[model samples]
Structure formats: structure tokens, C-alpha cells
Target: MSKIESIFKSCLEPKEVYKGGKNIPASNKKLYKLSSNENPLGASPKAVAAIKKAAENIDLYPDQTDIRLREALVQDFDGQLAADQFICGNSGSELIDMLLRAFINENDEVIYSNPCFLPYSVFSRWYGAKLIDIPLTNPNYHLDTEGILNAITDKTKIIFLTSPNNPTGTYIPRSVLDDFLSRIPKNVIVVFDEVYRHFADAEDYITALPYVKAGHNIIAINSFSKTYGLAGQRIGYCYTTSTIANYIRQIHKPFLLPITSIEAAIGALNDKGFVEETVKTVKEGRAYLSSEFDKLGITYWPTQGNFFIVDPPLPEIEFANKLMEQGIMVRPVSQFGAPGKVRITVGNQEANHALIQALEKIKPD
Candidate 1:
């Protein structure tokens, strides 16, 4: 065997990488991509302008402290959080890895949801942590906090809770969250993923940032990609206690963030008008899609996020294939453990209308 292979035969790394939605290439016609849940209105004008301006300074390294981005984030929250409480990453996925690196040890137990954020399982196992996946209740797919609490043991180290959870598009209500937090064991750290926060419109929807401000052992992950339409620039961050933030800082090399990316994020935060418009656009698209689905007799869970899951009239593969044939793209949810259904992102008026037309054509006779 090769030296590297022999030295790491027992490593927890998987041979296959994550497989999710993608934008299909080589179509002769125009494509309305509803695959990845990217911002439909496009990147914020301010962020785009920032990227252009910062591109001139590409030779310089990023500010290791990321003070500007963190400061903007603090102001974004109306100064409820200190800049020290923030830790930046290439994306929220990296923050998850940082948590695993800082805390998870071999045989240490980690709890997350089934149909969970796909990365939760990958990162947990990569750190040699024991997996305790709690299944969200069927149909609605809401978090079963009691089931999660019941699964806790002395070995448990982390629990990931994705509000406005992807693929499923549901959230833990405020009452449920309050009760769960009160009963959570002191030893277990909670990872609250909220990258889709800006798109959530349900009345009961709330951010877990308040808990972080109160010094709870929670890390709330969010991103510029979803809200500001800078997905290609790749910026993400989290809110946590200052102590945890410092530990992450120790293990993380801050210079890895690109200078252009930092400037773009800061610019995005300044454009409150753009964020408001993006939210308004997504809200309208989601309502249009939901109404169309109802008319077509489709079965779908009510969603608080920018996307929703749909049980199409045809088989998963066949249905997805048909959609593609009509110059549209969507993701199959079988990989998320929600087989026989597909997750669709809310698009702009033009894209949403195209998708409904395609669905209407593919509907059963």
C-alpha cells in the first residue's frame, strides 16, 4: 500500500463527496433553475459594486481579524451582539466543521435530525463521533425535541437544529423552542442553523440569536449567500458566546477569507433596501408556487424557508426528468431521506411561471 494510504486506513473520511442540487449545463433553450436555493433576484447591487471595487486590491491578504465584516453584522442586528461573538467561514458548512474540530472527539455522541442538514452527519462521523439521529415526525417533519432529549446520554456532545430546515422547510415553533431550551442538558451544545432566516415569513418564526446574546451554549449559523445573493462569493458566519468564538479563532486561520468576499459581505449588509426587496420577491414567489401546487393537486408541506418539498404525481426520477426536458431544474429529495418527493426553490415571477407551465404539461392525463 502507498505510505499515505497505510498511515490513514482507519480514518473516518468518506470516499464519496456530498451530492445535492446542481444547475444543469448545455441546454439550447433558456433554463429556469430552481435547484439550488439561491437568491432569485440576483446579488445585491451594493455587494456587486463592492466586489468590483475590491477586485482592484486582489493582491493584498484579508484582514485576519475580519473586524469590518463582524462589525457590520453587529450593526445588522442593531448592536444586540458584540463583534467578538462572531466567527466567519467560507460558508456555514465550514462553521459546522469548526464546531466538530473544537469539541467532537472519538466516540463522543452527536445528535441531529434525519432529513437534517446533510453536512451534520458527514462532519460528525468525520470526527469519529457517535451518531444519534432523531427522526422528525412524519408528514409535517417538525423537530421532535422530546425525542431528541430522550436520546441524550453522557457521551452526547452536540445537537444540530436547523430552523426553517432545508428540504423539509419547517421550523420549531417559539413555544417548542422555549420548552426545549429549558430542558436541554448542560453538557450538550446546540448548533442552530439559520442560513435561510431572511426568507422565513411565518408569524411564529424567530431567530435563535437572542439565546446567543443571553449567553446560551448555542451557535446560530447564517449566510450572505441566501439573503444578499452572494452565493458565488461564499461568505458565512455564526453567533456564539465570546469564549467559544475565541476557541474557534485559535484553530482557524483568518487570512483564508478573500478580501473581495469580505468587502462584498460588508457591502451587502449596508443595502437594507436590497435585503428587503429580496425578501419581498421570495415571499411572492413562494406564495405563487404554493397556490399553483394546490391547484395541481400536489402534496407539499407548508414552508417557512425559501424552498418547499413537493410530492409530484409521477415517480421521482421520471418527474425530475420531465421538468428538465422543459428547460427547468429541481432537486430530487431522495438523498435527503425524503424519498418519492423533490425540493423546489422559489424563483422570480418569470421562473416560477415557467415551472408551473412545465408542471402543468407533465401532470397526469
Candidate 2:
């Protein structure tokens, strides 16, 4: 190891990075990119217009005092929570990092479901937190409530609950989450990553934002990347108690969101028609793909989000590579710790049709 390497913690000297859904080396225009759960309809037209309008103001610094983005979110939520309770970050992913920075100390226990958003593990390691990753229950892959309740200790600080979980795409039912929340000690703050809330159509689903208002130690994070199709804009925010929100704001630097990103997200909130259409498209595409997979005798878990896990004809890595070669891109979830599974984002009709066609060609006789 070189002198620079010598200064790093030896056990974690070479950090494993989080990989996003991306195309292959030669994949730009050729591949149907369905790996990232982005809105296939693209960013809301209203958001695009807002971004164009905001681009002229790039010379000035972003607002730190009166954030129109957070102000706008009040109307978006139908006045469920006050503007003071919401805080914005560059993306929902960044809020996790901010949470860790504000609350975590050395050896503080950070607990989350195993095979969750990859960053939960990565950020915990970076913050020197004692990781307590509990495995999800078998079959449906929902949160293992008892396992997590058992794992808690006095050192436990944060619990990450990713509803419509990444890779598995399962969620915590309302009753199950209520019971779990009631049982958890008040000192431990539970973070709900509900970025994909728009796509979850399950009857039992409920957003945990109300719990924050009710004085529960909970935080709910939302993103504009999925249903709003503002992934390129990279804007997200969280709902927490005004007290916790204040602390996060203090820890976070000034002008966290770019002017264009803020304007785009604000516009996205007003684009109700666009959001409804995106959700409609994803629901249709999801049903279409599921029915096709059934006909091909492929095994996959039912998903509430815009993506689901698919077991292909070959091992996951090889299967993912094969799809890439055939002008498609899907994520292999080995990094998310499920070895045999591949994740496919529900795409537009054209893209979804192409994926099924590709799978048909590769299906074992």
C-alpha cells in the first residue's frame, strides 16, 4: 500500500462503492435502459418548463432563508405538514448521508433490513456505526419486525425502513408497521424511505409521515425522481419533527439545492396530470410484464414499486449480461445481497415489449 493508503482504516481501506442502474460500455443509444426505476415518460413537461425558466437565474445563489421548494411542498402534501417540518437535499439518497452526519457517533448502532438500499450499509460503514442488518422474512421478503425488535440495544440510534424495498419491492403493511412502531423504543429514530410511494397501489399501504406529527421518532423521505420523472434534476426532501428538521438544516450547508433543480421539483409538484399518467403507465407496464413472465414460466415476486425482481434462465450476472448484449439493461442484485435475482424497472410499452422479446429468445427449451 502507498503512503496515502497507509492513512486509511486498513479493514475498510478499499471501500466498495454503490452502483446505480447504468448501461453497458457500448449501451448509450442502443440499449433500452430499464435498470434505473426512472419515469419512462421523462420529466414532467411542467417541470421541464420550470427548469428552462430557472436556468436564467443561475448567476445568483440559491435561497437559504425562504425556500420556495419547501414552501411548495406544503401544498403538495395538502397541508398535512408545515413547511418548517420539511428539508430539501440534492436527492433522497443524500438525505441518508445527512441523517448519518447529524445523529451518528462512533459505535452508534445503525439497523436496517438486509438487502435494502445499498447506501444504508455503505453509509453506516463510513460513519463507523455498529451495523445490525436484520434479514427480511422469507417468501414475500417483507420487513422482519421481530428480528429487528430483538436486535435493538441501548446503542441503537437509527432504523431504516425502505418500504416498497429496492430489489424485492415489497412493503410494510399499515397494521404491521403500526405494531412495529408501537413496540420500538422511543429513543430509536425510524427513517422511512418512501421515495417510491407513488407507485405502491397495495390496499394495506400507508405513508408514515403522520407519525412524525404525532410525536413519534420517525422521518419520511420523498423524491421527485420516480413518478415525477425528475431523476436528472436530483431533488428530494424529508418530513420530520420541526426540531429534528432544524438540526438537519444546521448540519447541512447553505444553498443545498441548485436553482434549476428546486424550480423543476416545484413544477413537478404542480404537474398532477403528468404524475397520474406516469403512475398509470407504470401500472400497465408492470401488469403486462408480470403476465408475460407468467406465460414464459419465469419466477418473480409481485412488486408494489415500478420495478420487480426476475429470475432468468441463467445465473443472475450472466443473465444480466445476456440482456445487455440483446439491447436491454437490468440490474443484477448480487450487490443488494440476493445472488440469483435480477431487477427490471417497469418501462414504457416499447421497452417492456423489447425486454419480453429478448427473454423469449433466451428462454431454455
Worst 10 residues of 2 by lDDT: 21-30
> Highest TM-score, which number?
1
Tens digit of lDDT per residue, candidate 1, span 190-284?
A: 99999998888778787888787777888899888888998898889998999878877888775868998899999999999999999999999
Give per-model CA RMSD: 1.4, 1.7
TM-score of 1: 0.97
Q: What is the C-alpha lDDT of each candidate?
A: 0.87, 0.87
Once fitted onto the true fold, the runs of candidate 2 whose alpha carbons sit more than 4 angstroms away are 1-12, 24-29
Show model 1 residue runs off by greater than 4 Å. 1-3, 9-16
Candidate 1: RMSD to truth: 1.4
- For model 2, residues 257-291, the per-residue Cα lDDT tens digits are 88899889988999999999999999999999999
